[model samples]
Target: MNKASRSTVYDGEVTWQRIADEVGLSRQGAKHVYNKAILKLQKNEQLKQYWVDLIIEGRATKCD
Candidate 1:
């Protein structure tokens, strides 16, 4: 994930509005971009696994 996508995940559990605020986008726009990125990642097993590894290594910090 990119900076914007990471920010979305960080704030989505609380409120996507927070993500929008952080990323300078509207709430709905943030949702759209986040959903699209997730779908893309899901469709690529290798990329998904890479993301999982990064998460496990604690290197997935809001866009590392």
Candidate 2:
């Protein structure tokens, strides 16, 4: 959820609809991705930076 969380953290907004539109995903799909990220962050404490970098890269690549 790096991109989605970036919306809230950096832009002070959490527009899932706009994110979905920009990345060509359904709104629910975007939310699903974000939720999965959340679970990962909570459950996988080790290698946090690795997962974070991966998430940011995914966002940079437009969720590809």
TM values, all candidates: 0.65, 0.54
Residue-wise C-alpha lDDT for candidate 2, range 1-64, written one tens digit per residue? 4476556533347589977976689999999998998788778777577787987996887745
List ranges where model 1 is wrong by over 4 Å.
1-12, 59-64
Candidate 2, residue 30: CA error in Å?
Answer: 0.3
Q: For model 1, what is the C-alpha lDDT against the true structure?
A: 0.79
Please identify model 2 stretches exceeding 4 Å from their true place.
Answer: 1-10, 47-64
Scored against the true structure, residue 34 in model 1 reaches a CA lDDT of: 93
